[model samples]
Target chain A: MRIAVIQFPGTNCEHETLVAVRDAGMDGEIFRWNRPEQELSEFDGYIVPGGFSYQDRLRAGVIASKEPVMATLKEEAAEGKPVIGICNGFQILVESGMLPGSGEIDLALAQNVMVKGGRIVRRGYYCGWTTLRHESLPRRSCGSFLLDGGALLQMPIAHAEGNLVTAKEGLIQELADEDQVIFRYCNSSGTAVDEFPVNVNGSTENIAGICNPEGNVLGMMPHPERAIFSWQLPPPGRRPPGPGPGRMVFESMRRFIEVSR
Target chain B: MRINLRIWLKIPDAEAATVKNTLVRRMGFEGVIDDVRRERLYSIEADVGNPWRLVKHIVRELVNENKEECLVSIDELDLDDGYVPVKVGLHIEDGEAISAKNRLVRRLGLSAVKRVERSNIWKLYIRSDEREAVAEEIARKLLINPNKDSYEILRARARAVGMRQ
Candidate 1:
């Protein structure tokens, strides 16, 4: 399957994401934002990789969201093509109103506010390893299609605006009821805690990732491509040499595309 | 009393240029908007005797004398005409503003500083007759994300009645 790793001006992770896609047995290429919009239709799946697009001029992802390429990406997504947005890519999707799939701005990934013990501990840019528990069932979402519910995967999240917040009432509850809440920040043992370091970015209800109602579009704050191999894993690596937990996300996208066809 | 510090870059503001470009070229505000300029507004609520002396210290702490220009006013914001000044600030907890308040009080020993509110003033020079309506549309569309931010249209008011420096 041909996958497009979309790149904006400041998108730094496109290369690694393309690497992860190829390693997952999918043919992939870095798709620039300035590219012809119709050319994007040739790709089977799309991945909006992370970076500070437009140098986060107006805000992270907002400027990039208004681009014409994103409009075409939305069309591709409507065709049930798997569209995975990682980190700033997630912000773009949310800003573009693609994550909720409502074709309207429904939520925002606000500034990171790290809270612990009912007090603000830290705020702003943070980069560190974090664990994500796949909250959706197997095949429920394209990005986590192969991951079973409650499956814990370790990944690194580096961002300043990963805090998911919604002013819309009952939206979080609605997402939960629809099984659209895909990944949640969790402890090593897979408990979705609501505290700093565990909850990570103080996202609503510890939510790290979410999918649209159709499950084709998934937006997540963590960087899965950063953990595609055992060698990329954090220190104290005693396990057998193999693909890392993050490989499943890409692999699952491939599988989802194949199954859809 | 409130100390309002309106700070703008002495150099060309790339952020404002980008916003103007995005709004005009991308979001289809080409004809409606003539230009977009931005200024950082810091409203510090302080109870201090010899307010002028205290403001000097506050300016020294907050305003970078190089590559930035500041206009100090007290009580009211007297913005220039020919543009609609839209004030955008985080409706949710603003950590930066909180930090600024703490810095002035705890670190700088400006104990009179009771609060500090920070906001971006987007000065939109609009060509449309319905300036306020267009400004609001632009604010909702491109400026503020309603989830965390809110915007206010700062209409022209009487000049600063308290003090101006």
Candidate 2:
């Protein structure tokens, strides 16, 4: 399968994403945001990677969400093509109203607000390893290849505004009921928790990632592509032998493409 | 017509204390800077002929009415037919502002100081009189984020050829 990694100016993770896709035994290439719409149709999957697009002006992903490329991405997503957004790319997806299947912005990845030393603090930007647990819903998720639901996966997250919020109260519950909730921050035992620094960014419901209702689009703050190799793990000695936890995500994406074909 | 635009956080102290404390504690500069409050401001100076119409469009497209408050004022520049300048200030919520102020005042030892307001300023210049549409488009598309901040049109007035004489 061939994968297209979308690159917006200031997006720094496209190369990593491409490498991950190639490591998974799939053909991968970079697709600039200004490229013609026809070029996107040739790829079987797309990935919007991380970084401060448009210098993250106004708000993270706000300007990039209005870019011309998103129109085509939205169309492809509607056709059941897999699209994954990571970190700032996730912000763009939410800003563009692609996640949760609403096509309207119902949620926001707000500034990271956490409790430190008994008081609320804006952690500004955070970078470190985190544990994630997949949601255990009967419905299939876009990225669920190598691991079962509730399995603990260690990943890295680097961002300033990653907290998830919704202006309308009680909407998070609706997302859960719809089986759109995907990965969540959890303890080592794989128990999802609402406390920090586990739920590092204080995302609503400790959400680390989510997929659209139809399961073709996924948006998450953690950088799974950054952890594909066992050597990338924190404290090299702690890494288990063989592939890293992040490899499963790409492996799953590759499997998803193969199955779809 | 000329217009000045200002965009800011809805709460005056939204950016206060947060950065100063971090700078003082994390960066090891406890006493170097006595106090600091960060604010964001957007200034739009346009030579568009239709000030009111432009203001209406800008308010609807650029400002977030639900999260922020905006005010419009008229400018009286001495020059005739000169562009009206619009100033927009962004602020956060009232309670958050007060709490931030209290934290800064107590921690920074600023009893003698009256007020500390910090903001960011963005200036937009419209050079063409006939291309008011371009100016309006810029304001609507690039000026602000409707999610958490608000803006105010501080002043707007039409420039007349007679005023130049």
Candidate 3:
């Protein structure tokens, strides 16, 4: 399957993301944002990788969301094609009103607030490894298609505005009922927590990732590409040589495309 | 009493330029939007006697005299008439503003400072007759995300009864 790793200006993770895609047995290339929008249709799937797009001016992803390329990407996504947005990419999707798939702005990845013991401990940019528990059914979402429900995957998340919040009432419950709530920040034992470090970015209900109702569009905060290989994990020398937990995300995408076609 | 510190970059503001570029080239505001300028506004509520003297110290602590310039207004916000000023701020808990308040009170020992509220003033030089409407549209479409942020359009107002610097 051919996957397009979209590389917006200031996108620093496209190379690694592309590598993970190829390593997952899918052919992929970095697709620049300035490229012809129509040319994007040739790819079987799309991945909007993370970085400070448009220097995150005016807000994290609002500037990039207004681009014509995003319009085309939205169109591509409506056709039931898989589009996985990671970190800044997730912010872009939320800003572009593509995450909820409602074609209207419904959520915001506000500034990070690290709360512990009911007190604000820290805020702003943070980078560290986190455990994500798959909350959706197997094959429920494209990015987590191959991951079983309750499966925990370890990945690193580096961001300033990853806190998912919504003003729309009952929206979070609706997502949960629809199984659109895909991945949630959890402890090593796979229990979703609501505190700093365990909950990571103070996202609503510890949500780390979500997908649209169609299950094709997915937006996640953690960087799976950064954890594709075991060597990339922390406490370096002690870990065994093998594929990392993050490999499943990419592999699942490939499997989803194959089965969908 | 409130001390409003209006800070603007003496150097080129890349954020304003990017906003202008997006409004004109991307969001179809080409002829309607002539220019876009931005300023950081920090409204400090203090209960100190001879507040004017204390403002000098607050300004010293907050404003960087080299790359930035500050305009201090006591109890009111006044702006030039040419553009529509839209003030955007986080409706949720503002961590930075809270940190600033703590720094002024606990760190700098400015006990008179009761609270600090921070926001960005987006001055939109609109060429349309419906400047306010267009400004609101720009604020909704690009400036503020309703989930975490809220915005207000600052129209022309009577000058502050207090002193201006």
Candidate 4:
């Protein structure tokens, strides 16, 4: 199986994601944004890796979403090809109106909230390890197959505007009902919570990742690729003797493709 | 023709007050000065011949699609006049506005002042005769952040006949 890692001008996570894909035993290739749409469509699966695309100008992922490649990516996703967007890639997916399968976008990853003294203000940038748990759903996708319900996975999150919000009420419930919500911020025991420190960016319902209604396109803020190596984990006790939690993400995708064939 | 554009957030007065107070308190200002307004937004300026098509494209492509309403105004200018007035505004919208204001109020002391709004304005200076096409291309392809804001073009008047300054 071959996976295409889409690279935008400011994307920095492509190399790492490519490494993770190759480690999972799938052929991985880097596809620049400027490449022709026909060439990009050749890949069986795609990953829009994270980075400060377009300098995070006009909101993170806003400018990149309008690029020519996204038009083709959107089309590929519509045909049920697996498309995973990590961090900035996730932002681009939402900005491009691909995730949640909302047809129209009414949500955004707003500025982070920082509580100082007693007042809440916008936080600039944050980077650290976070725990995520899978949300049980009947519709299976390669991106979410391995994550058992309530299983905890350690990952890193680095961003400023990571707070997920929607202007409309009940949107969170709508996503949940659709089985689009795939991951939630949780404690070590895998209990989902909305309180801060545990839920770093204050996402609604502690959502860490989500897929579209069709279950093919996934967008998540955490850096799963960065956690593929055991040493990448924080603290000695949390580290395992083998590959880290991130391997499951890629492995699941590869497994899904192999099984489907 | 040269066109000046003003963009601002359509925020409620009550909410704007909270933002102004927070800026003054957090940034260590001696209260907001008379001319400066507070809000997180952007401004852009480009010189083009016809301002209509450019502003229309900007509104369609660059402004926010959500209910976070934004206004873009083209200041009235006489092509013969050399000076143009430019303004821009940025404001937090929907739930964010209230959340930001509440957070600021909680952290900083409350203030008696009622209203504060945020936006950005752009001043475009054009000397060329081919304004419409150039401006449209610039607005559609070059301007930034169309998904989070909105825009408009104010009709130009003939320097208001003979007005008393």
Q: RMSD of candidate 3 to the true fold?
A: 1.3
lDDT of 2 by residue, B1-165 (tens): 323333335655423343344335544435443454332322334455555654555445445665555544334322212232322233432233344345434654333323323334333333445334532443334343334434433333453221100
Candidates 2 and 3: which is better by TM-score?
3
lDDT per model, in order?
0.92, 0.67, 0.92, 0.66
Alpha-carbon deviation at B63 in model 2, angstroms? 25
Instruction: Chain B TM-score per candidate, please.
Output: 0.94, 0.34, 0.94, 0.29
Worst 10 residues of 1 chain A by lDDT: A231-240
By summed lDDT, which 10 consecutive residues of candidate 3 chain B come out lowest? B156-165
Docking class of 3: high
Q: After superposition, how far is residue A115 of candidate 1 from its true place, in Å?
A: 1.1
Q: What TM-score does the first chain of candidate 4 have?
A: 0.94
lDDT by residue (A1-261, candidate 1, tens digit) is: 899999999999999999999999999999999999899999999999998988989899999999999999999999999999999999999999998889888999999999999999999999999988988789999999999888999999999999999999999999999999999999999998899999888999999999999999999999999999987888846666889989999999999999999
- Given candidate 4, what's the lDDT at residue A96? 80
Which stretch of 10 consecutive residues in model 2 chain B shows the poorest summed lDDT?
Answer: B77-86
lDDT of 3 by residue, B1-165 (tens): 888899999999999999999999999999999999999999999997778888887888888888898788878787778889999999999999999998888888999999999999999999998999999999999999999999999986654344434
Off by over 4 Å in 3: B157-165
Residue B41 displacement in candidate 2 (angstroms) = 4.2
On the 0 to 100 scale, the lDDT of residue A147 in model 4 is 71
TM-score of 1: 0.97
Give, for candidate 2 chain A, the lowest lDDT window spanning 10 residues.
A136-145
Residue B3, model 2: lDDT of 38
In candidate 2 the C-alpha lDDT for residue B57 amounts to: 52
